[model samples]
Target: MAQSTRRRFLLAGAAAAGALVVGWGALPPRQRLNTAVPLALDGGAVALNGWVALAADNTVTVVVPRAEMGQGVHTALPMLVAEELDMPLARVRIAAAPPDKIYANIAAIRDALPFHPDDTGNTQAFARWTLAKVARELGISLTGGSTSVKDAWLPMREAGAAARGMLVAAAARAWGVAPDGIRTADGELFHDASGRRATYGSFAAAAASENPGDAILKEPHAFRLIGRAVPRRDARTRVDGTARFGIDARPEGMVYAALRMAPALGATIAGTNAAGVLRLPGVLSVIDISNAFSWRLAGHDGAPAGVAVVARTFWQAKTAAEAHAIRWDAGPHAELSSDGIHDDLRAALDGTEHHVYFAQGDVADAQAHGRTIDAEYSAPFLAHAAMEPVNCTAQVADGKVRLWLSTQAPSIAIGIAAAVAGVDREQVELHEHLLGGGFGRRLEGDMVAQAVAIARECRGLPVQMIWTREQDLRHDAYRPAAVARLAATLDAAGTIKSWDFIGAGGALTDHFLRRNLGLPGAGPDKTTVEGAYDMQYAIPHQRIAHAAVASAVPLGNWRSVGHSFNAFFKESFIDEVAHAAGKDPVAFRRAMLLGHPRHVAVLDAAVRAAGTPPAGRAHGVALHHSFGAIVAQVAEVSVHDGAIRVHRVVCAIDCGLAVNPGHVAQQMESAVAFGLTAALEGAITVAGGAVQQSNFGDYPVLRMGQVPHVDTVIVLSGEPPEGVGEPGVPPVAPAVANAVFRLTGQRLRSLPLRLA
Candidate 1:
């Protein structure tokens, strides 16, 4: 087809979509909001609910509900299913799951409810149940919080095991033998007594009808694939460029889009001059993607007001966008700067209102009896800065909408797109692609909504919008800048008598709702004080509280979220108290963790792995438990001419039954690289309600030369598997800071530890 003819075809499709939207607006309001339904599978394959699908060719396909962003989840989850079926990883195929309640992430939501990890009271139980109910009903399918494996651990295994049992039962019926006498191996059912063997493919029809008793999952000792270092399913495809990432989604008659948004957070477009931009090469149309009415109702940040320039290619769109002129409303937040944010948080620490998440004996009485040591700490806001800049593809035609993107929360994305496009939720179809990298940024539905909003203007055309790196960095739901005040009372013998911790920051409640569901919620957010309040150290008289301050900075989950910086504040303060009382930091922490053997074990392993830093090098130690995993990190550092160089990090983790020990070690290494970058140079400052840094030039990651050698030790345990992706992140920054303090004698309480 010629270019002109193709353009006309796309224009006609766009017009059809526009007409559908107009028709949709005439329908009753009740019709626009439809209840979400479960998955209805297509194709000739046998659909076993939502997590497993089988073909007659003995191709066992396990449906993964998690997004693969280079964390090895694509392989880790497959192990759970393949292990139960007693099949090699090579024999099974992996597929993306449809958005359904059967795939909802039930664990993370339960963990998010406001309660200490140790809480078991009625209030806690009630909150947990309420959260669980909401998750199950809404089908809250997401892939973050290091929960993919844990959530899939039991269910995936059972699904596969049950299918395996049915195959054996079918073979037994056909061969006139007891089901117990039929053994299955490598996708085949066999009976040794009768010397009868048949491929699982031959029994597929009967197996689907056979009733297998309750699936008894394999024990650890009998496991063939769960614990081994199996290669990732996506490894070969990734290396050979065969993997289809979000950026690779190219729809027919697709036109590219490049966006220029309001520079300030929570700002809107006042006007634009698009005449000259349209004259540029390949520029198709200039469309205003910002929906002021819906943006206000959605209450989501990082959906900054923007104008999109659709063109023949991304480069054409991007080049034309750079020249487009626009006036932005900086709004009431024009004066909100980073320095002011910190000062306000610091001041709020002294305010009367504080919600304590954890408490023990009377902290006031303990402080009155013992000598107290106090310290203040702060951390700058951080950006997700994922490798793939925010992008989405959408096609709206004939009263229906289609979306293809790399997203963590597809259920939320489906609703967000349909609502934004003025279509019914049931009319939306979402095709999830592999994420280039998420790091918690993709958890929000902003990009999905933004794309649909733009696509609606395309008449019935298919549009793919790819944000520039600057656009991505400048408009992100940042990690909230925080301030912390910590105090410890020491007895005569240098024993810790009391602990008081007050953390003040931008609240996570509103952002949690917006990012999770494009809605709003009330009550205290557990994420606000997650790392600060949930430490397992056995301080006798302790009080941990969070002071919610006011800030309009767009805040969302970054890497470890609260733990990303709170670990620096809490663990570094503990080191200060240890030093103030003339005690060794490691031994001081050891004394406090008497009953916590799991925590103690990781700490001891980290210490042994690190041994001792030489006289020229200083060591810092930190232990943190998160996502039901305990990680201990020891950093060896040397400071010379006021520059700190981290030489090595010895990390020990007990994530319970390491699914793949090699992958666990790899994740730890990745986390150290991620955390060290933040510890050394990560910061996102706001000035005049706009972000200060735009790209890697200013907000740099740890380069290869700067990255330290990470020695990883995975502790074997009997408990169920926990999170490996995020648990390793919390302890790294503090370990580096403690090491710096030991070397320089300057207690660095703040993040991106600077020396004087």
Candidate 2:
């Protein structure tokens, strides 16, 4: 009997080993690093792997895949190549790359998996696996979520280093010395032992034939351009008004188009009185808008059905469009209102089937373990309100589709344009342009798809469709409104023993899957519940859960997404807990963040930067980590005439390393303004299922006078750089709100902190 059991065990072990081997083989290999190869050269210039090009004049052009949406990605990404290639940053130029899998954004997509930052169980593992499979198979290229730098960090460096090595090898072979004897700097290679020197451009042709075997990247101490405040490559063009945004593009024979989308998602045009306007002016024809909802296929953003009026000029199109009155079907969502959605979300707080995104220790007995504190917080829906608005130029003819636009995801836009124009994906040509601003709005390609659909009806004529500012604001896929019910238990000694959090809102991922993938997205969404649940506060017993309630309102990522509101929710509650514990807010937080050195470092730095605020002025501090970055902020504020005014903010960030200290500082200031707008007056209301805000007059951002003086301190480290754009956005609001609570004695839990 013993021998039989032993034989069974041995067989089971062998079977497990065989399965492991098969699974490893089935897994997709990592993206190829040496995918770069020299392309055909012309005019004594050598092109390498669609990234680097060396001209005989010693000029370097780096092909950048990410979009330049005022985030300095175009300037920052090429800096990576310049640093590794030992070339001057001023000499490195940028060129847009073609839509190809080799340049896909593999990091951003995988980072969006439906798993909390603290999640480590099978659910998290499965989410990662699914995300990897999708990213590897689809090759999604996006430039949002503050991922452009992190995504291109290694690839850009490797491209430059490898190219430089090839050039050095060519020089070494000519000098009759080892490759190590050849040193390169500022586009010139020298062999000290042989007393031979030549510009990289002089050996461009021979270098293309030489092999780039392996490259040794420079150490942190060797970095010259990095960590320095380098000037933006396009600074001259922007100030000179030569920067071409989507609104500036003009294709040959392209006529103008103006459109008014249905007021709400699912609504349709019942009829249009275009005959009267068609004969009035330069108006040509009215085109009905309809396309496959396979791209950005969610809510109101999925190629919304509308009517486009094409004319000779934009003014003519707008005038003619205004003259025509269209009747809308006003679908089932016509009865939906902001108040109604809020009520539904609040009702979901009492739901029984909560999708527990994170759990630790004994949360079921949290109330019994300590004194309980409970609070409810809410935030309103928001619009993107980008300065450039939404515009697309499209022409579909001869089984080909062409578009010119500023989009965060050009590859996605290409696929969407192709699908709508009834052409093969390979037949699509995209002219990527710069955006005035994105704020997550330009990430969708629905506007491009809509333009293509309009052009499809035309007689192969190029058409440029521009949404009126009112239309852009009203039709935007605004950020979802949400509410959270939080409960924390503190022991007799004032230490937090347990925490329970519940949030309800429209799920971005679920909405995306339902519309785009045609699947039942059943589970917790990381975006909706991220900042609320994934906090670093030390608690023995904790459970964070989110309940999803569907709404007709359109939703997309708004800057920090969940962190925007979750910070206000969690950080405000911490202030309340601190007061309840009879402890100072900063000291109370410092106690909870004992074991977290990185968090403590930023918190201490912010406090020191703040120095000593005025005796009567109230100071509030909040620390949060998001997108692989940690941030702490101290807001000094005052109230006058019932208005809360933030005078100054001391900010500290540890985003691994400051790739560009100037850019990092600028981002901090930008985020402060962006976040302050939300804290002061960033809200979108729905009435009868239509967005009530039409333009900036109704949806205002922070003006120059209202902008607070932001003092930024970057925490230096040898660690690899993390996200920079969005991490600065999350902590600003909470820091301001906490200060307001101290001044007013009323815990303003909701956004747009109102005072009476």
**TM-score winner:** 2
Report the C-alpha lDDT of model 1 over 235-299, residue by residue, as the tens digit.
89989999998889988888898998888877788888999999999999998877622643455
- TM-score of each prediction: 0.93, 0.94
List candidate 2 segments past 4 Å from native: 1-44, 114-134, 290-301, 513-522
Scanning candidate 1 in windows of ten residues, the lowest lDDT window is: 1-10
Off by over 4 Å in 1: 1-44, 120-130, 292-302
What is candidate 2's lDDT per residue for 47-76, written digit by digit as tens? 754578899888888888898888898888
Q: Candidate 1 overall Cα lDDT vs. reference?
A: 0.82
Alpha carbon lDDT of residue 529, candidate 1? 79
Clashes of each: 5, 0
